[model samples]
Target: MDSINVSELVERLGSDEDAVRKMAVFKLQGCVLDPSFADVFILEDGLTKLRHLTLHATGNTLAYSLTSFSRLLEVDKGWEYVNQDLVERVVELVVTHPLVNILRGAMSILVFIVSHPYTASNRISQPDSFGFRALQPAMTVYPQFLEMLVSRLSSADHALCANALLLINSLMREAITNDSEADWPKFIKQLQDLDVIKAVYTLMQSTALQDLSHPLIEFQALTKVLLRKWRDVPVDLNKSDHRRALKSIHLASNPERVTTPVDDGEEGSKKRHNPEKWRRLGFESETPAWEFEEVGYLGMMDLTEYVRQQEDGFPKLLLEQSTKLSEQRCPIARASLAVTSILCEHFEIEKADVDDAKIQLSFESRTNFDKVFKPLILQWSLLHTAGLQAFFRLWQTTGAETEDFMKIADLVRILLEAVVGGATRVSDVHEVETEIQQFELARLRHLQMELLELTYEDHWGHHLGQMRDELDHEALQFVKEQRIRCLLAGAWFSNGHGHKSDNVAVAKQDLNPSNPTSQRYAKLAHNRRFLHYADFDVRDDEEPDLEGLVEKIDLTTVSSVVLAPSEPSSSTTTLKATHKFISTRKVTIYGYLLANSRPASPKIHPRMGSTATKTPRKEVTLLTLHPQTQSLAAEWLDGLLMLLNYKPITDETKRLIAMVQDYGLKIRLLNVRFDDMALAGDSPEIPSREGLDEDYYYDILGN
Candidate 1:
């Protein structure tokens, strides 16, 4: 590879043959890789020739030179020369065409100019240039170079904006790692500038998750020196949040990872939001090791904001901007919901954070749910529903994940709990109903005034009153319908406490929300329409389990038939209808059924997808415990039998108890009362008692 003469290389740039010009530039750039060679290159007006070609270069030529420049800057210390006039002209060209033209070599020039050590450092205390001289003149012009980049970032094509982010990230990664922290504050301030933040966010907003590694990953890293409380960060959570979110490939700083502390919580710890507790919210037992860049975490935080807007804000421009970007509702639904569900158990998230934006931040943007719920619950509800739809869409699109099922359980419990709590909160249920009707009318009147008009000239007062009256009637209808449903559902689950951290019963449900059985129980118990794909056994005319289960009798060799199956059919199996046995809280029995019987009346035909094998297989049928046997179930089962007043297990019930355990109901329990009444009254602590052994009991898992 013989290098070409610099002057001849300069002239050949305009040669009729593109390959010749490309080869010439490639050879010239290769020669310039040495810092010593920069002087010679500058000697023959080489920069002028390079600039000429940059303005007219085809992708192949430009890509070669631009890539060469990035490499050259890594080594060369003397090539930061551009005549004042030429630098201004080129910088202006980049600023103007940077946004509109993706392949016009503007990015290449910015890359070249910004690579100089002058503009690379923050304005204050810039130590030196590439060659180690503190040349104030060179430093003076540096701001202009960044200004050009900022302009491009603010108004460029989305892809170009992505490139601009790449440029900044590249610089940031290197500087944060090796450079002194003296100028870090200014640099970070620059980073948060609207121009810069918008560009980075747009790139993140546009990237396909399948290709999360493209460019974003290449530049992925944590700003080891953050503005607030950078110290004492949990290394594992940092590593996990980063890996799961960013899929980061490069880290600027290899900060030592810290072990998340495990706290054996006491009464005081339970009252506070604990980091250890958040880790406990992992869909499973342990936090798996995964690392991601800070950018991914930041992007996810933004997603929470998007959720807030979708659920409560509904700003016309924010939505319109999203549409213009063609995001296809992902930000509204999946991205935000993923964070919300995770954050529900994620560290630092208090219930207060949900509306105030403390954990995820939006309060400064002025939309805290708790503070403004009375005025904006409906507006927020609309956005929340929109966000919920997006979450479903995202999860559906991604196929089922382990966490997906757990999240499902949490969300369902939350939904039901909200309804139940609303029902129980006010005394004099009928008056509460009347007030709800009035509230609906007031809300409707407010909406009418905003969306349409009760014009002043056209019977304004009368028209306004009519609209209010009409909605008032509709409000009454809504309250009536809600009351019927909530009355039934609330009494069943004992209201919103189901989703609370202290709610033992529903919290247990969170472990397996997506399980087909749980979904089945939820639908049947609530009498909500059949949920996605569920299969439940509801038989009460005879014995509940035997009624729906198909039983086969083989008088030949079989002494008894048993069954065990789980989830829906292999595909498209819907939960069978389940009828509730009672309107009030019924003490359903669970544990071993010691009774000896001949005909398991409704011969269980066996659930469709049996985990049991062929031949004479023992079966496990999931059934509700009858009130008569509930006490016996409690006696026979482990601590799982808390709800029922029953005696201890007897030898007679051991076999039946083992059968019940397989269906996943051996949960921790206590005698703490969490019925709907508890929610409307004062929050009281349960008195401590020497808990029964875990072999069958708990210390109040009350929510």
Candidate 2:
């Protein structure tokens, strides 16, 4: 096409006719391939028309326009024809365009325009060459563009999300170049703040998006850049610091800093600025492998520190999602494992860095167990098998010597203490009944075998045996010193609130918009449910303080633990409670605290022997649903019977027992059994069964 035809085509691209505009874009695509057409395209203001066509055109027309634009920029000396206005328009389309394909096209054009060689000759007259000048417009609008692109990462449309990722990667590549160098610290910090890297990683791992074809290479490129920066650049250690200031500290910034630069064929091109030549010479590829191949002792410590940093700043949403996705064996969970494994490898490298003789075995033992391994193991235990595999792989690779065994021993001690608490149990017979309980037991057993193997008959004199013996002794002593403890909660009923103690304040209920009158009735009812982690301690004489969910009940309380079925409500209930059980299965504990007594006689209920005598005792009845199952309620009943010294003698005691029996409660005597000597009583005070050879069992009922 001549200059006259270029001008006509540019005019026709802006024509009202869609077909005319599409034809104009199609012709321009061919014209842009010729070296002589650059002047005609520039003089006729073709870029402005092309940008308009890309934004306004639809379907094939838009695709044609984008192709034409990219070809124009890719041609020799083609970038010099571009200007700031045209760049801005393309970026605007990239950010706001509804179609994923169009967005990808616009992004492609933008990346090409920014990175393409601009001048006719490759030689640069000055530091601010054509490539640098062309990129200045992009840098000016980058923050806004980046914000928009990052927001698309969470789009339900995987294709849109994938394109958004590619756009961001391209933008990052352009920004971080030597020509228009981004502030690496600031740029990376912003990406982290937006959770861009994490979001990309999650997208890569999402099972929901697994079937959809995505730009994995682009995603990898973006994450690699981010990780490279995370390792290379200094970032703020304290995430809570809003400023996100980079610290002066640096660690292994460049392992191959002395690698000489190679001369590229581009005569006047700076080798340092030419990323392609650097990639070709293998500096970028080779350096990471060398630096990360083996971590020294300090490097291991550094890895530990990185783990700490990640754990502390891990997002709450991700934590919640981890539990849900862990069992799914999804990409996100695998990604977490991959990350953990890499860090573990770093630990191995670091451990190798320290000579075995010079290594402070005691310090390594303590730090590995307490600071590194134990904390991770405990926190990730909920991850089940995947979590176990990660830590186990680390353990197997890093150390298996005596110190490592000691660390394992230390880990076992912690798990034992946490799971058993103060239970006097050293039995091999585990009550691995429920799935959760079974998982806990299995983990304990795994740890036990692992620790025991180091101390068996062959290595009797090893420190492992001594540690095992100490552990066994500690276990027995702990069990004897500790009282029985269990979690419980308060369940609300039709007539009254579940919480019997006035000390327990009722939580206010939320107002219902549809039925405003229900709010007033809720206040009048005064019954509030308290459901939180509650503990019942048998040793304390003080009444259980109902603070939030947990409570500690006194064993000295004069009362009985009764299981009662919930009474059906006579009045209409709110929508919130409609789906809930109409009649809840519940347990009610009746007691009287002497501490709440007054000299004056309280008004007794007419049904109770109309005695208005002068001992004002506060009668308390705490009610709650059976935690886990009703069998637990029965266990509570039995435990309370043992602690409160229950026996029916007086009519009142018999009546209470009869009342408990009336409510389907199993009334069993607290019977303690022993191998050395059997207590001669229908009921024994301390209901624990122990023998010199057998494991301990707490028998609540006699044979």
Candidate 3:
């Protein structure tokens, strides 16, 4: 290399042709690694000017030079000149740099600056929490820059446009494949822009580049990068809306991933974001991975994210209130619908496994499982106010929407439709006698289908006790029907009505025209087989009137609904599941409340097993009635153990033996106080009634 051409190279390093300047600056730096320049370049101002030239240089010209300069500055004692002002300017330009490639390599400088002990210490001392942020500028500008990059993709300059899009797209794909979201909104917005859509669509139209045939790169960026970031935020650090409003971006992004499943590690990483990436890396699997990706999956992430945030806020009472309002049971319903919606999206993914019933968790029972929404509810409902609502929703959907229940409803609908189709195909057997069974099948099937629809819709809107008021909301109709059905079921099903003699006549009267589902079952009104549906207080009547649904449910089943505690609804029933009833064996123990449990239809009969019989599920409790504060010592463990058949042995007890292993709950109880009621009553203090055992916490919940 030629020496002493510093003057010429500095001039050229600022040239418009980035490649020429990049080569010149890099070449000059290698030659001048010599320490002799220290004396000749002694003036601090001269070094400052050089530093400015290196830092402010654009594109390759600047990036190539800055990489060496960053090294040189550290190698020299040049950091002595660093101050708050200089550091800020250096960080600002590195962050706001317009060129994508220039910005990419330039971030290391900010990373370098903030990584210094003094710098890190200085940042933490300040209140804004920006010391760490200065190092990760990608978090702030990434979303914005992604927006710009995406817009450029639709440009008319084919070569530049295609090259730029290809490079940016690849970088984004690599990031997503790594399951990283260095900057989510910026990154997603770019891919979602029209340029990406048009480029993929236009490429598909022509058989130009065989490489352009796949759109996995774009989709991976959308789901793994964008949507995932939006949903899978750090719970403690999150600042997103509970409903996932950012998903409007998906409208511009490919939506196939909503139904696909993800693979583990690198085999999955290269799948969608870039097929060539997979090919280049020598990872072998089918190109363009689409499994574990889907809208339903995204929905799960969104709701789960809210739960995670709620989880983070559990310690702060005021914050817990906000989280409860923000997440709580609504997400449970949302996730329930979302998983069910996934079933509708792809028929083949789930081959209908036998254990689906076993694994199929109620919104109440599923706690801490990754895809579960229940843990989040438990986290929120632990609050004094939200507990009851959590319990109510849990029970409301239990009998009406157990996985077994939905499965049964599905079977009925399918058989009914099959019968209807068969009746349509036959012309000779059109007589009323021949069609009676088919019609009956269709009617019963329709009832089941409607019930499924009811359970699928969420009754709670944005707040507890606040019913969704929009008349046009189809979801509201589902809630209203449930309310009416429960109301009518309350009054007529109980023996208090005293007309328990002719069951057929009762069924027919309940199925009369006034009932919601009566059209097909009207004949039952005369036979006393009418089913009491619910009770409702019509404004015109001074008293709540008794009404019934079109079908006759078992009276024993209706009695199980604990409608308003001792006040049984007309729909009361005692019939259990098809299996034998898990007789009234109750115990008190501790576990999280599932959610707001509402009264549900009575249990179904149990299935006859070959050897080991299936355990019957309890009628999930409707709305957890929290024990009084004064009763924590005497009642807390006893009441909870009653439900789970569990008792606290000692802190040394293992989880398998201990029915409840919730850490957060144990913390809450420590702070909770029950007043000394005996002192107020002048009966003297009782040692058995107060104070928690310190050993229990240190062994179980304490660090």
How far in Å is the alpha carbon of 38 misplaced in model 2?
A: 9.9
Query: lDDT (CA) for every model shown?
Result: 0.36, 0.42, 0.34
Error of 3 at 38 (Å): 14
Question: How much is the lDDT of residue 10 in candidate 2?
Answer: 79
Error of 2 at 545 (Å): 65
Task: Identify the runs in model 2 with alpha carbons over 4 angstroms from their true place.
Answer: 1-11, 14-19, 26-64, 71-77, 96-102, 114-142, 156-159, 174-182, 206-214, 225-703
Residue 626 CA displacement from its true place in model 2, Å: 47
TM-scores for all predictions: 0.31, 0.34, 0.24
Clashes of 2: 6
Q: Which residue ranges in model 1 land beyond 4 Å of their true spot?
A: 1-7, 11-92, 96-106, 109-127, 130-159, 174-183, 207-214, 223-229, 232-703
Report the error of model 2 at residue 294, Å.
7.0
Better of 2 and 3 by TM-score: 2
lDDT of 3 by residue, 1-703 (tens): 3465555665665566767666766675564445555334433233454466555666566666555555555444345444444445444554366664444334434434443333455545642222333323443534444445445445454442444444455444434443234454444454645355444434333323223212322332233234333323432213354224323222222223222345664343232443222221111232312211344334444333443444433223222222342322122322222332332222222232323422443332322222211111111112211222222233233333323433433443343233322332112222422342333434544555444334323321132112223322333233334333332322211111223222233222333333221111111122222333332223122322233333333322221311112322323223111111122111111111112322233333344111111333223222112112222212322222221122322122223222232222233323433242233235664568366656553446766
What tens digits encode model 1's per-residue C-alpha lDDT throughout 1-703?
2455666776786678889878877776667666656566667766666666655665567655554544444564324443344344444544444324432344544444444544444334434422212222433555464556655555435556555555565455445544554454356556556355444434343323122223333332232123111222223444455454322211111112345444766433223333322122121213422211222333344343453444434333233323432322222223333433432332222222222222222222222222212211112223234334434443344444544554443443233223322432112333432333233323433333332232221324454455455554444344334333432231112221122221112212334332222111111223332111113333223322323323222221111111112222222221221123222212221111112322232222245321222232222222322222332222212222211111223232344333333222112111222252244445657887677555865588778
lDDT of 3 at 287: 35
lDDT leaderboard ranking? 2, 1, 3
- Give the Cα-based TM-score of candidate 1 against the true structure: 0.31
